[model samples]
Target: MNRRETRDAVVHFGPDADWVREAAAESSAVAAADGVASYDEPEADAGAADAAGARLAVCELSPDAGVEALAAVRDALPTVPVLAVVADADAVDDALAAGAADVLVRRDGVDDTALLARRMEGVAATPAESRLGAESTAQLLDAIDDSFYALDADGAIRRWNDSFSRLTGYEDEELAGMDALELFAGADRERIAGAIETVVETGSATAKAELVARDGETTPVEFTGALVTDADGSPSGIVGIGRSLTERREREARLARLRQAVETIVDRAPLTLFEVEADGTVSTVRGETLPERLGRRVSEGDAAEGVFADQPEMRRHVAAALDGEPAHGLVEVGDSTLEAWLQPALDETGRVTRAVGLALDVTEREERAVMLDQIQASAGEVIWISTPGKESMDFVSDAYEDVWGRAPETLRSDPMSFVEAIHPDDRERVEAALTEQREDPDAYEETYRVVRPDGEVRWVHDQSSGVYEDGELTRIVGIATDITVRRRRERELRLKNRAVETAPVGVAIHETAESAGPITYVNEAFASVTGYDGDAVAGEGLSALAGDDTDSDRLHAVASAVKTGDRGSATLVLYRADGTPFWGRVDVAPVVDGDGEATHAVSFVQDVTESKEHEQEIERHLTEFGEVLAEDLGVPLREARDRLDAATDDDPDADLRRAEESVERAVSLVEDLATVHSFSVEPRRLSESMRGSSPAPAGRDE
Candidate 1:
């Protein structure tokens, strides 16, 4: 080849003057030594290479030269091949990514001068395509949604489609001087450069990289690139396609979140998720269950056999689910019961792949339901609940039939029927109490009579309390107890009280005590006889009618009888309500309780004032008569008897005379007694001296 024909023209864009000079000198020395030509165009304009008829473009990219300057040279001559020289070996990937046909990293005193000359010779010998062919290819690249770009040997952006501009939100003018490495976030630029380097070395490469958007937001992009070669089979640049993965990544993240949520629910819930194969074999199980790990088929497990024994229907349901039908049923194993639901799992072809099942334990709930049934059947009291203010009862126990003479179902259907059973006399009062309880949501209690269909009247004590929710009455729950026997005994007690109040003799009852034994009851006769009203003396001591002059011994005797639960009587001097004294014959008896202790005392009192006065008068008369006999009649008789005794001893005739005189004296004594009798019979008619004085001789003191 001729020297001019073998020599190739080169354009360099490095702003580092010293590096440019050195690179050019090295490249020229190698070209001359290798029998290739070199024409270095340092600090060249965009069109300098076309005017100089350059064979290859050489961009010397110093650390400061960056991607933009080199890209400007490459864009100026799209048909020519370009080579890049860089100072740092680490910048090789960036140089290759920017569309470098070949890169040289300058090491101190270590030159790849011969390699550079050969690469330039190969690029210069390659034929360039016509402008029309280039224009048509550019039009096709710009029409795609993905970003397409061409990078030079210097790793400078040479050409890019409109999609590239749209993806980064940059116009052609703004992108003209922009470095390709500046398109990514600071941290991702190296990674992107590495991926681009792989594409240049591997002929074709695919990787993920981060691209910075116009607003400074970074997006993930999938890059596919292939090296573009010159006619002589020398790498010239790279043609790349970048598809933004923003939407696809977002979809994947959402799927991950949804999967996490479902797993959380499965872990926390009481449900068990199971999978059964199409052949009716258990494949997997999750959540709370009989085992932590299971590998055998459902038929191989002992639990499955136990379930089949108690719930034959479960197998059928599971089978149906495996056949692409949804099914559910209950299965009991030992003491536990499970509610199992199953649905078919499908494949992409809509065929049944397996059955997915969920199981929940319902043992406690079923047992509680049975317990409630037992209580409702056996309870004696009528247990019930109802909606607040509603006429119909929500639930009622079977005891309603025995107590209210109506079925529980009847009351539940028409609660008014229970109210209608209330005795007519107490109906209004019972209803009023219920209304008040509803208004206040307090406890309800009412005792009223209920008239049965058989005309039997029975008393019932109904009690209820409101169930409140958010300060409002929601329901009423209560019990109604039969109290007929109790009410009947109360009625009898009232009749007995009426009889005691009207009793004839003075009757008083007092609590048993040593002192201040307060009177609790006083009959009408007691009030009249003691001259103290029953109301006035009730709570007063039993000795209220007994004055201070009353005998202490008699009072103690009555108190002792009451304290010891004994019976005793005393004729005591008692004062009336008017302060006048009277003799009373009182009989005291203790009222002992069931415990055999005297709790109270009852007394029967009678007035004996008139009879005692008459008896006293008779005793006074006897005493006066005795004095008359001794002093007046007895003295004369004694003198006569002495005379008679002397006569009898001296002469028989004289003894007879004495006896006659004694007889006469005895007759005189009789006469005196008669006079006393007359005074007793007519005391008021006698003089004041004769009334108190004995009827004796005048000289004698009576």
Candidate 2:
């Protein structure tokens, strides 16, 4: 019997006690291993539990013995783990709320005794061994949920709870005696040390820092610390809880960016931002004296309708927006004209929460015919003039025919016919954009697909500015340019980048001359091979990746290729971040522009250590064979040749015959050696790669 197994258990009786009995029976086989003792209901009180060695408390939850029964069991064994068997759904929550350590819903009839034994083993030791009654310090510390750490007076971590261990990615053994300040860095460590000093002077203090983990990952954390006082009233140590501030910091950054964007539009531009309640109350308003220019006297927290009391059209637009649908209108009050766009803000359940809107003043518009009467269109440009509100076209440029593949007469005849050239999917959005531009000309910049008469769709980027004379606005001038080729190039570049990013071999792109310049990009494979993350190496020079001991010849070869605007390759030893060396064949290709001059260079690296070692082994074996061939056969052949050369006229035939036989023997030896080496074996590979967009090596596995 081990200490982890239950020695004593308490079971509380209720009307549905049969469920508890069934569970206990299913687990009785293992429960009997330690000569387990049991105390039924009201008999073994919490005070008597210590003497009885009670380690686990079991109870059945029902209307008869629900919260009240569970509370009594908790009081009897405060620190002991309580396993509650629940028959209905309602009692599960009730048992948990009453401090049950674990609740087992009546599912699958409690068929597995091994699982029950596992849960029992997970509980703490008996109160006499661990704490005064049944109180478990580990459980109490973990109950904090947030990271809990204890630091000594010297700022070294003396103790930490499970939460702190998990959050910091450190094991219990690794955390002991670790400097608490080491978990943070730089200015943060100094600030945290100051905060600890503050805690010693005061009662409590709070500070924030980025908590760096075992693997160098940092988490933004807010820590609250308090001083622990000894009997002499002197500071002994400090204890603190660290709460993660990652989400809060991210949300704050996002909100700050949004506020900056909104302020830029409402403050710098001639626009007013407003939010109103259902009861016609203005809750928010922002702008640069736009309200004053529009003769609006009401401020935020005032009645919204009173802001436009002199203009009934604007008042109706606000009311219509609050009711259900979006509304917009133009109001002419005194000498200025105003355009307002209002829509209801919907909640998660699609309920209308409030009405928000932007108002623009457009009283100084100029006549379009007078502004564009003398301007001429340039190449690839479509300069057009229309009515003050774009109700009809007054003039169209020749470039319109070149880009839209139709004459300008059609648009002049029917101003709305411009929609016919827009792609079907984009026609609605384009129409809405045009309508918005007609209402407020400053909002006219757009990019949309324009379909020609010949069925070729082209992308058009158009921008326009309003023309005004004196104080009355009258015209809108626009320029539309064809951007189909640029769009195609951008899309193709993206696909090429994707192909490069997923290439198998390590790949790096530099500004120019290999790594002589700054490194621009590296894919995941590069990071895997080098053990240096992209963020760590990008924008750094080659010195960051290679040391003085690394091969300079191969690197110089790649640089020479870049200088000559040619592709080149060389074999070299490359080192990972841990200084593990591998034989690498690096191929560098220059990226050229239209002038055929290199603007950038891409380097592809493959580990060739295995294949290079194999080739070396083959060469070594061949060298040994050559030496053996000379020692075993070279003398005999040489003697035969000398005997033939020294033969007299009469005996020359004999010597000649002997030399011929030796020659035949040499021929046989050569043939035999050729046969032995005839079997073809494919060379081993460094890597096998799929067909990629760029140049890459194909190597089979060793």
lDDT of each: 0.69, 0.68
Q: How big is the RMSD of model 1?
A: 18.7
Writing each residue's lDDT as its tens digit, candidate 2 over 1-702 gives 012334445333344433334444445332333334334442223334442445566665554433445555566666666777666654553354345666666655556445555544444233335532324545766776677777878888986667788889998888889888888889998988889888877745789888999999999998877665443446677766787888888899999999999998788877878788777777547884435766666566777667777779878888888887899887786876777899998889988888998878766542243344444444568887776666788767878898899888988888778778999999898888888886677778888999998899999998777777895667777888899999999999999889888889988877875445566888888887777777887876444556544578767766667555578888876667776555667787888889987888777778776676666558546644755665567677667656656663447677577776777678567555544444312221211111121123356432
Which ranges of candidate 2 are over 4 A from the true structure? 1-377, 469-472, 513-515, 541-549, 563-566, 620-702
Candidate with the greatest TM-score versus the true structure: 1
Clashes of each: 13, 10
**What would the TM-scores of all predictions be?**
0.46, 0.37
Show model 1 residue runs off by greater than 4 Å.
Answer: 1-380, 425-446, 505-508, 512-549, 576-580, 592-598, 610-702
Candidate 2 structure, TM-score to reference: 0.37
Model 2 residue 437 lDDT?
84
Task: Name the lDDT value of residue 694 in candidate 2.
Answer: 16
Clashing pairs in 2: 46-76, 364-472, 364-473, 365-472, 365-473, 365-474, 366-473, 366-474, 366-475, 685-700
Per-residue lDDT tens digits for candidate 1, residues 267-356, read 886667776667655533667543432212234334343434446777787778877899987777656777889899899999998878
